[model samples]
Target: MSISNTTNFTNPSDFILLGIPGLETAHVWISIPFCAMYAIALLGNSAILFIVKKEPSLHEPMYYFLCMLAVTDLVLSTSVVPKALSIFWFNSRQIDFSACLTQMFFLHCFSVVEYGIFVAMAFDRYVAICHPLRHSTVLTNLVVAKIGLAVMLRSGVLVLPCVLLAQQWPYCRTNVIPHSYCEHMAVVNLACADTRASSYYGLSLIILVTAMDMVLIAVSYTQILRVIYSLPTKDARLKTFETCGSHIAVILIFYIPALFSFFTHRFGRNVPLHIHILMANVNLLVPPMLNPIIYGVRTRQIRDRLLRLITHRDT
Candidate 1:
């Protein structure tokens, strides 16, 4: 998805997704776990939304950010998994050029938005732990609304250009994408025109915004940890550390696979194609699936409510 200096442009063809490339034969089997992961993601995130709405005491900045994360995760997973399952389970591979661009947009958009939620959640922890006295005054409903709006706007603004560029690229080269979804790089590789613009746009957006958010998150957590350890009693320190541990776990789950997939896509020439693709899929699917589970297990409020709901079969 890129540009050409010439006035000539050829209409793009409908792209054929080759679902896992060499592993096409096993796509049916692959669909099983993918379907399970999607199901779990749907159920887990929906439960987080449900439990938060039901418990009055859970109304706070942290849970508000958790709700944003849950909703973003739901969008992130749903954007790709079902279509991927169509490719895997039923041999449905033809995606219209417009649809391909659309998928590329939303998938990348919400994926980045999901990372933004992580940052917001991190900041929530920083405030709650480091400045406990002013947490409410600082992250009030209006400020939370602003932060959520900022995350959505930042993601939408940054991602829209790439999808637009994808549409301009002349797609006379080939239409078969050798992966499960319409990844930015995969789509760019299909353009007959020079694609340096698309590549640079994508890399710049990822490096600038993602790297900035990560650095801010790291700084916030560093401040949080410093405050946690300074508590006069060991019990105080342990309890505080336990609260932030799950957030740290969520961070690791989000970034590790994402960075690896990106690295393999650009520099891992020696790596197998399917492995890279699998890593990309993991970057999208695993975080959404695990974020809720991690929060439910770690946050006492969510955990208690979830357990009670399960035990009582609450309406």
Candidate 2:
């Protein structure tokens, strides 16, 4: 194969990213808010993780999943937000090919893991609500550990090949990505060679993974609702619904924006760049920021524990 056709960047003259238009003029303004967001996301998620770890009452499977979710959020935000803030602040938009690929890998990996965690959390709720008699058997400590491992393994293995395939594509001329983070589609679009295979593979994977998880979660919640309705006491039904209300809100917040962004990017090319960028960042940032808040507020036990911890620390 010709040197030009090869994916390997043997020389520095490989790819040039045409960064977002008008970045020089808008960098400073965007930087301020972006930096603030990063600070809040890091501090917020870290605080949740610390609270969950230090509190013995939070040793249950639900809180265990929340801890995992917090960790994933921290990883996700740490991977993308700092780089984004740097670009906004210093106008240093250049990212090495290997570094870009690594970013894409981790971003996708953690995103997949986050989806898996949502599924697991949904299952936890289902078991607790629908099968209270067997909740312990269904979601034991060992089972939670195994599920966590499966989430990591499933996402890691499934996304690794896609990242490798992406890195194999020759990026000849354009390397600039529009958004702050290394989105897979955006990165693939930079390749000089045909990216039809990579695009199709990615779409297939997204559809398969996301659709399956959504179906499972939906089914789990359906059974949970059924069980809730079967309860003879109105208070019992109301309490059960209250327990799941926050999670359902979180599910909508997390999935709706992501699905919109993904579909618009894939099929709705006519959408404006600013709109796309806005939706993409919202998908990444909002969920991380909202998740901990939702759990802390909706679950009285967690809220009470968080309050106690704060009060104790202050004392």
Candidate 3:
């Protein structure tokens, strides 16, 4: 075959995922835990939704924000894990260009939405603690609905250009993506054409959306702490901290690994490629798996409802 003909086979219409480097012999073994995590995430988030729906008391702004978070986690997890499972169990790693782009879009869209939701939740906590009297007036259902809608729209609009630009580019190079699922930059780097615009856009999107949201969340918590410290008693301080425990756990779970993975990809050139890929997958998986658990355990309302749910179901 000619060199051009040889290149054609490597540049397939569908891309194959490198499930995990240095562990090809153990893909099935690796898949078991991932499968469990995905199952738990799905069930746990669904239960959160169900409990929030069935319990009329949970119809308030806090649960409303949580419901949004649960939905975002569900979408985000579903977008990636199924494909990863396929790659692991069935060795079916070929993903069409359109399918890959679709996955990338949802993965990023929900990710951004979830970040926005975190900021929304931070604001919810802020109002609940700092301005308790006006919390109801400020975060009416209409307002929460508007916030939810705005977050979703903002994520969708911001991520669309990345997809459009990617679609316009011709992938003349090898189509093997070095991660188990379609990630934004991994796929972007595969394009043989000039990708400076896409690179800049992705970086800017991360900064504008995720980084900005993190800063806002931090500021919200700072104000919340100030309010808590101003309270007269140690009991008051403890109560305030207790109220924020679940959100704090979730914020740490969601951001720490994500930011680490982001920085690794950008600056950790000495880091192993597999480490980068593993952390990326972990960042996606850990939050969904842990969020429901954290909320169920730490948030009294959710824990009480969950216990009541289990007891009633058993009876």
Candidate 4:
């Protein structure tokens, strides 16, 4: 059956994404790879969390931030992957308005929190590398807990209004979302009502929250670089830079495509839908999938622990 027939949406469900065209043609073929990726994301992120929680030696502010990142990755993958798989495999792409809104809300919420956590991680790295003697005192357990709470609250405050505003609009067209998941702009674009205000508000939030967080992260890393440069020994400088390399790589991986996707969707729709879809998937999936591997390989403790766990499990 056609999407319109299945959805029976007359009023234009503001949030029901129909997924991109051409997916229906390759549904069966795509399902295998998509499901495999989702399985890996779920299992991989969950294992990260389990390892961090079970290992007492990892009970520190740095690992705490890593745990938070793992949780965010799991939530992000969970929020988008299953529904996407269902759409591809079962030919059940019709998401209700409320469900779509809920998905969009959680997606944005976790995305914002992910950025906040990245900033926090940068700060942690800065302290550890630049002020090693004072790192413990500066980033105590209490302080880390407060920071995590603050990140959640900040994300909620920034994204809640945007989701509410987008939902209030009247959808006047087909409810089929052209992508696999319910993204904020995709939903807003479907509205028959004037979306200028909502668009502006969402853009403003993106600029304020994302831009500011990136600035703070940049400043922290700058200071870190200066300290690393001033070290007397080349080995000390190399070790310090090594500690931050994975974080820098992850940051670029996470932000560049996201910003590009956002801009392309908003300003470059003239670009092919396929390009947009590709970029969007990269922004959503690649970072989460790579984060664990990057951190696991770079951080000796996590690497050793992961190895030990795997070895013990195999034995």
CA error at residue 143 for candidate 4, angstroms: 0.9
Alpha carbon RMSD to native, model 2? 3.5
Model 4 lDDT per residue over 182-265, tens place: 888888877777888889988898888888999999999999999999999999899879988888988898889889998898
RMSD of 1: 3.6
Candidate 4, TM-score vs. the true structure? 0.93
Estimate candidate 3's alpha-carbon lDDT, on a 0 to 1 scale. Answer: 0.88
Q: Which ten residues in a row have the lowest lDDT in candidate 1?
A: 1-10
Arrange candidates, best lDDT first: 3, 1, 4, 2
**All candidates' TM-scores?**
0.95, 0.92, 0.95, 0.93
Residue pairs with backbone atoms closer than 3 Å in model 2 (clashes): 16-175, 17-175, 17-176, 18-176
lDDT of 4: 0.83
Q: Which whole-number lDDT from 0 to 100 does residue 240 have in model 2?
A: 88
Give residue 25's lDDT in candidate 3 (0 to 100): 84
Per-residue lDDT for 88-152 in model 1, tens only? 87888888888988899889998888789889988988988988899999999999999999999
Candidates 2 and 4 compared by lDDT, better number: 4
List model 3 lDDT by residue over 1-315, tens digit each: 111212544234677787887777888988888889989999999999999999998899999999999999999989999998888888887888789999999998998898899999999999999999999999999999999999999999999999888878877777778889888888888887889999899889987887688889999999999999998999989988899999988988998898899878878999998888878888888899999999988888888999998999999
lDDT of 4 at 102: 91
- How many clashes show up per model? 0, 4, 0, 6
Candidate 4: 10-residue stretch with minimal lDDT: 5-14
- Which candidate has the highest lDDT of all? 3
